[model samples]
Target: MMNATEEFDPAVRSILDAAARRPVHERRVSVDGASLSGALAAADADGRVPLIAEVKPTSPTTAGTRTEDPVDLARAMVDGGAAALSVLTEPEHFGGSVENLERIRAAVDVPVLRKDFLLEPGHLDAVKADAALVIARFVDDVGEMVTAARERGFEPLVEVHSGAELETALDAGATLVGVNNRDLASLDVDLSTFERVAPGAPADVALVAESGIATPADARRMREAGADGLLVGSAIMAGEPREATEELVYA
Candidate 1:
């Protein structure tokens, strides 16, 4: 049988390896007043499933580079009715940077999420976004990371791919959870992954569906499957961001 590290997708393993080499450093920035969970709640109250559009330049799965300015792309998404913005800051594999998140957060009034394979509390301290993604699959102690994020005044969005990880996240006091449809082990996407896992999630916590969503139909499908928010990356980044975002938001 393969060990945990061995089971990781090659791309996921590469990202973790790169993150491990970074120095533990602090780059403190003021937290924006916008709240990710609050945005989702507000959308829910308005009878809308919030769209968390992502500002991703490129990913391991992307076909080519996206040269658009991060701030411009973010503003377009917000103008299209995106409730929040997710800024990828992984740097190596994702072609993202903390500078981009900072710029986008400054450019838009909407909440900004720092999307990275965070492994330590110090990583949270280095960012300045409104929320941080603490992936359960990558961290040894999901609870510890969640607590650390809250201590730093960041809304922690615990991401899990399976039912067991979902339970672990809940046990760790996670109020905001993201169910990623893409499996990190194989990098395969299946939209039903959210439907299968979302039923078990408590109603009080905000649930976000991530990846594998492209059109209005897909957005509606996830909403019907119990998603409070949708986190879309490649689909929005592939073409006209504003129109793409509007399609999902209005869906």
Candidate 2:
């Protein structure tokens, strides 16, 4: 049996149930949010892989919760040449909060991706973010999530771990598809995961490699394997944010 934390359905259900209690009207997103897709395109336009540095406070893999201010972290990433930012909003497992997202959005000019166990359309209404992550492993209706994110002015970065999920993402009309190298169930990192699945991705859609990307070599490998961009968290957060971001962005 899969661990409860790793399973997608139960987690998503919990998140949605909690979100339903909040009023959408009070949480409407801003109209002038940054464009995530545009930022990624510009980074890769010069034939270099763009970096989407993540602002993650903690994770199952980390030793402890992050204490650095999110605003400071966001600024460092942008200063280091990161094309965009990914802010974790999952409060329990990741130690992330919506307030972190709000603060980071205010601190950085780059596009921000709200990374969470998101499901409800109202979730988008609750945040003033540029892009949202819709994990393919969890969502029963990928298209619905895509439509909701797009309607709310958020470009959805649909995440896929396998070929089937990639097809689902493509069918859902997702322009930006992220291939997560970490297995949701085991939380294991497989660098080959992206390379294995990226070849099957449609050429037109933007391909982003997420997780387990640390060194410039890792970034170079992902880029060589067809990833136009990278969404990196742990490594960047563990070191000098700006230096890590610049290293990966140019790698």
Candidate 3:
């Protein structure tokens, strides 16, 4: 049986070539100061785990939702307590699109992270076109992706599932790390995995908790465990995206 990571084809491209045609002047718009460095500093200063709110309809793992409107949800996230926004740009698996990302970016002032199956330079370029930081999935070659991200002036957020992948992310020069708790395959989260991997992360790196967080207790655990930020979606969308976003991030 193929793991979720192995299922994606080597021949498939992560981004579209048409990205260059988007209005050049419109590529990068203004964003908040909670950037790569800023998010880390703010998370440290506020003593509250900064939030990375996600925008998506459904996933292969969890395929149930309503109103897949990116702009509305993105705005709600900002109106909530989200410090940043993450937009899924993968159309094949996640039903996401560049238009969604652009729409959300145009409507919100927070920093955005282009969450995708980024495996090619085109993907990096596409995220750069929207001026959103790129999340280099653990399955991708982190170093190559990081190099690609920097070449386009986008921050590379290295995501990892296991401790072994953690080293790969650091070697890739990813100053921002997102530890996705959900396996996507097993569709479960082992919060302790963070403890195992967090120790390997250099002090300079900004550690973020991804997936499986529900309440203030969940947020408190991550904050106490030294996670610089938290990236959540399902839980936030469970209630009013705006209401949940506020409670999750600020709680």
RMSD of each: 2.0, 3.4, 5.2
- What lDDT tens digits, residue by residue, belong to model 1 across residues 1-251? 11354677788788888998877767644464468989987877776659999999999988998898989999999998889999999899988999999889988988999999888777787768789999998888889998888877789999988999899999999999999999988999999999999988888988999999998899999999989899999999998999998888888
lDDT assessment of candidate 1? 0.88
Q: Candidate 3 at residue 200, lDDT? A: 85
Clashing pairs in 3: none
lDDT of 1 at 32: 40
Candidate 1 total steric clashes: 0
Compared with the true structure, model 1 gives a TM-score of 0.95
Error of 1 at 26 (Å): 5.1
- The TM-score measured for candidate 2 stands at 0.89
Q: Estimate each model's TM-score.
A: 0.95, 0.89, 0.80
For candidate 3, write residues 1-251 as lDDT tens digits.
Answer: 11334433332322322232333332432323236547546645765458888886766556476565778888888887687888877676567887888788778877778887554455555544323343444234567767766666666777787777777777777888888787644556787878778888889888888888889889888878888888887787667898888787777
Question: On residues 165-228, what C-alpha lDDT tens digit does candidate 2 reach at each position?
Answer: 8999899999999999997766788999999999988789889999999999998899889988
- Ranked by TM-score, the better of candidates 1 and 2 is 1
Supply candidate 3's per-residue lDDT for 139.
35
2 against 3, candidate with superior TM-score: 2
Span of ten consecutive residues with least summed lDDT in model 3 = 11-20
* Full-model lDDT for every candidate: 0.88, 0.83, 0.68
Runs in model 3 lying further than 4 Å from the true structure: 1-34, 127-140
